[model samples]
Target: MDTIFYNVMMKSLRNGKQWEVLEELAMEMIEKGIQLDNVSYSTIITCAKRCNFFDKAIEWFERMYRTGLMPDEVTYSAILDVYAKLGKTEEVLSLYDRARADGWEPDAVTFSVLGKMYGEIGDYDGIQYVLQEMRGIGIKPNLIVYNTLLEAMGKAGKPGLARSLFDEMIRSGLQPNVITLTALIKIYGKARWARDAFELWEEIKSNNWPVDFILYNTLLSMCADLGREEEAEKLFDDMKKSELCKPDSWSYTAMLNIYCNGGEVEKAHELFREMLGSGNKLNVMSFTCLIQCYGRAKRFDDVVEVFNIMVERGVRPDDRLCGCLLSVLTFSKNGEFGSVLICLEKANRRLVHFIDILDKEEATLDMVKEKFREILNESVVEVRRPYCNCLIDICCNRGLTKRAHELLYLGNLFGLYSNLNTKTEMEWSLNLRSLSVGAAFTAFEEWLRALIEGIEHNERLPTCFAIHTGVGGRKLSQGLADSLSLHLKKMGSPFQQSEERAGWFVAAREEVVLWVRSLDSKSLLATA
Candidate 1:
């Protein structure tokens, strides 16, 4: 309840009004276990702004986030309106940019605010740009944007360009109502071009369309321009007397121009009053027309008075505003290069970082951390080839060494002979594959011979070849058939000692043991 009292006081400060103590108590009584919904939070932000509590509203929005509540469309719309009214358009656009990052889409009212602001600044190009964006997204332009574009372009003297827009609207199946047609007529009338203006009038007439005062006024102006003054007066009288429509600003401006040109200055001045009195609050264009007329008639003082009135009504001259007092004079870069070079530098640093990782052989959790950092850096690298080369080197180098002498021992245990030359040649050539297999058998037999010799050198085991032999499971004596032939071949090791110098398993693996053999006399006689 005490906290509720503080909140009510804050609300009062926001609204520029006072709160009752009992109302705070009642609000606290209504507080429930449910924290707050998005709707209630959004409403609070909106109400804060309506009370002119901008900072309070922003603070509340932040608090809502901390409290896990989301603000919705109405909340943002109220804030946008406040910004527009305060002329803080830049801040308004910046917030929207941030909102996009947060994934919140601004609705149409926001776009409408932007459209109106652009229209006020006379950014005719901006109008088209907004239209293009809206159309690309399939957003239907509402009356405010559509009509404001027409008025802005019409005043800017681009009615011919705006005609294509009319066809587009019609193609969208919207009828050109009286308001739309009137804007078109005034656009053509301001340019004093009768072709499209009168054509649209005749199109309306032939289609049995209801012609309003704007149609008749534009038609009368066309007549006066073509020297059909009598017809112009007839149409003016008819439109002003009609029960359905009366002569408005367009009519009076046209008629006054006619009278003033015939040197009927008094009648023209009367018509001007009647025009202003009849809900035709003169705009800047109205006064501009009057100034042109007076200057043509050589009424310098009247032109000055009208110009003064134009400024007094806060209609300070637009581009067409300057008269004689006239004029004053007024008077990312390389962003792609910067962006591309920054990307290149980042990529180069990434390659260096990867090379460092390959150089470090220590393994632990820190290695995993380095690996993940490399992944992230590569994501930032934006270059593929250098990153690929770094990875290939890292994997190949790590494959070459894991621990001290570990590769050689592990290779022997697996019978793989982890020699890089063996692996590479085996991988690249079929002939090397056969050699690799033969080499494995050779190493195994050599290892077996070494084991047997080492045991015999210690005299721990006897040779079984002479002690007990078997011929298909029966004991047998030694054979004596080739004893003499072996003696001769062994002595020829003396005759062929020069040839024995040549390699033939060194030729003495058999010769030295054979020469040491005693010649069996029984075998010599058997040979004879």
Candidate 2:
């Protein structure tokens, strides 16, 4: 009678009426007083799960425990699957822990779920851990378990290791499926190990294996990456000839991507046109591939045209695309000045999100070299002095210090980027003492120390003339750090001084030390 009722509940589950079936079973159990066991409780739990009624499944599972019926491995496996599918990995693991703590070892299906979840995050070790535990428990793995493990290893770029596992599975009398072979193709392609992909591709074909569209699509994308256009075309032809599969938009996009990347944009455009007639909607990524081809060919005008086409098709341009277009235009040899200016203005408009009104003056510099030398001599970018000092500070650090200094004074005369430094005065450099000889030496030492420490830790600090001189100023604190640290020790230590000079040097160092100690390092770097 229990068997008959179980079959009836299974039928309701198959027909998608788990809740109604559970309701009928509860009434039957109540009126007939049928002896409830783990199987009976699990049957209702499985039904509740079918309707995504996890709350009811837990409630009935508790009832089963109360009736002295413990859940077996299969019952726990079912619950784990439901949680995993809902992307509640935390809950899935929690349930697994509870089932195991209660002394129920997970079955093959449970191992499969846990293996797949870890695989999603590139955790190949987790899959192996599960597999080893299964073997230790004397439970042999099914083909699904091994296939998933092989795919995870392949996707993680251990194709050679994955192939070894494939052979092991064969030795264990299990055959790897299409999913395993396709993953091998991807790994080989990713590593530019085309020979491996070709060998595996041939093996899949020679075995008369039933291949899916995904398997061919992966190979096509791999061939594109490998610049194997000849082979990619042959595969595309074979895909068309195969009666079992149809060409997908992804396959077409792969071919077009390869052609465009191979300096054959015309072919890519031609194929893109052909695909439209076949009723395929070119997704944003595929369209992006085509646009990149135009950018590569330096036909940037055509890139604009294609962008318009995208807009016409109701495909909105994303921020990354906008940024790429701006970068390309900035580097264009003969870009229209008006257009470039328009883009700069637009980009600046967008920069309001990350910029303060005072930050827009970052480009200004208007002091003459005579004026600049006077300020350095005096040790400050004084009130109403041109921003020429900051630019001079930055460019000189980049091996163009003299040129940067010349440009800063020249720009000051002409008022280019002159408004830059006027927006905000940095707080740290504000009250710094005069640029004494001793103060210069101390900051220079800090720069060199930072470099040694950076190299010791395998880190890097930007060293430029503009960088050094910029921090050397009294306003912003970091100009000196950029200059000497990045340069090959332009500033030198006066080790040749005699003991008589030592007293004076020590006295001077103490005074300079007092000045820098009063400044904030955080605000120094922030403004710098």
Candidate 3:
């Protein structure tokens, strides 16, 4: 048969989704000495792409180029999408440049695919360039293109930009679909714009727009993060009521987190049981949230039980879960410590070793520090702060003030607590906002010693000094601030509570110096 006949037959097969047969017919055509034109190649490439046969699509695209028959815009877009799906950044860019040079103006579909690729790689500038080029070519962005851009902005955490684009999309006379609303919800969620997210969700409901699983889950997760227990419960109920959507594992996990954050352990447990009864497998996050809730409530037995269940189900604990387990150890009784330690050993051996060293009375500060450094180096960065806080809290509970100070110092050395102390020309401040109560006290003691040494050496101190113990939101931090106030009053320290600040104590330079002079050097050093 001639090339036209082969092309017609292949296009029919491609439309029927017969990808394998289509490819075989193409090979047969080649063997019969039939020259494949651009249409024939485009049909084959599009078919392979639709079937997720990315390698086959690339092969046919290369073959088309080798035949010296330039691909039209459709083929270019198809192959570009294939390259994008494969994460072939170099190939995507090179082909896009070649297409533009050949005078192919990409349509909305092409721009959407490119926007997705750029978004995945965190190249916001490239997405903007795509938008600008699309406008320059007089091709107004459709719903698909706008959805892609908004999704990218969400991932980039540019909520403002996403809002503007969403507004522009509506003004362009294209109705917002579920994908568009879902992207906007995600942007608001990521940026922590709770008010905006809730408002948008309300609008979505008022308009009675069709809501899918992703849209419902996105809102639920946002509510979980913002600790909007009422809002999350409402969203979860609405999701259940929707015939088109049901609570998946992530949905249950998010709702469970909301309950956990609100300290509604009974509700969390009820929902967790319901989730398991529905045959939705629990993930590490679900178990972590449950353990955290149990830890906070001082229910050590429940924490261990949930952990045992997680192990039985073969859900290997991650670093965050291990960190949560360590946190439980801080509140655990001396006898209860060993039980949590067992779970920690199963989760992460390094953490177990670190805890073991800290528990050992004979372990020197150097040994604990060495083990700490090793664990910090091996752990993911997000867990480092929590691990340090838990360890310092544990030490303080054990009356290991000196060891706690050394660990806090090592945390600073690792740049985990860089802003614990800050100096300026007008004010010198010690920020213990992120530190545990015990670590904060240890840091304050160290700062006082340094102040005395500086005064003895005639070093220039700031005109005013402030100690920040953090605000009144956290129970432990507020308790520390209150205790520090009482301690300062009992010692006749020069520092006085600032009337304007809830957690700040201030002292003038001369008062601080005199206070330091009056403090017995041996007594202060002995306290350390």
Q: Which predicted model would earn the best TM-score? A: 3
lDDT of each: 0.49, 0.58, 0.85
Report the candidate with higher lDDT, 1 versus 2.
2
lDDT of 2 by residue, 1-528 (tens): 865675566556636755876657665775787766666667777777777887777777777777777788767777776776666777877777777788887777788877777666677777677777788788777888776776667656677777787777778887667776776677777777888788888887898766898999999988877678889888989988989776788988899778876868788878777776767676666666776677656676666667666667776555444444433343344434244324334433432221122123343333233433442333233412223333333233334433443443454454432222111222111111222222233333343344344444654322211111222211123433333233323322221212442211111323333433444545433322
For candidate 1, the per-residue lDDT at 457 reads 60
User: Cα RMSD for candidate 1?
Assistant: 38.3
Model 2, stretches more than 4 Å misplaced? 1-35, 51-59, 82-107, 121-125, 136-140, 154-158, 172-175, 187-193, 225-230, 240-246, 277-279, 311-324, 331-528
lDDT of 3 by residue, 1-528 (tens): 599998999889988989989999999988988888889999999999988999999999999988888898889989999999899988998998888887777888999899998888878788788888888889998888898888888776679988988888878888889989988988887788989988888887787877888888989888887777888888888878878788888999998888877778888888877887888878999999999888878888889999999999899899999889988877887888887888899889888777667767799877877888899988999999889988888888887777787788889888888777788889889987777666777788888888777888888889999998766422333666887788788878888889998779999998988888988977787666
Error (Å) of candidate 3 at residue 345 is 4.3
User: TM-scores of the models, in the given order?
Assistant: 0.39, 0.57, 0.77
**Per-residue CA lDDT of candidate 1, range 195-295, in tens?**
68767877776766667766676677666554445556777777877887787766777776566445456666667667767876666556655655554
Residue 206 local lDDT, model 3: 88
**What's the best-to-worst order under TM-score?**
3, 2, 1
Q: How far does residue 300 in candidate 1 sit from its true spot (Å)?
A: 17
Backbone clash total, candidate 2: 23
RMSD of 3: 5.1
Candidate 2: TM-score? Answer: 0.57
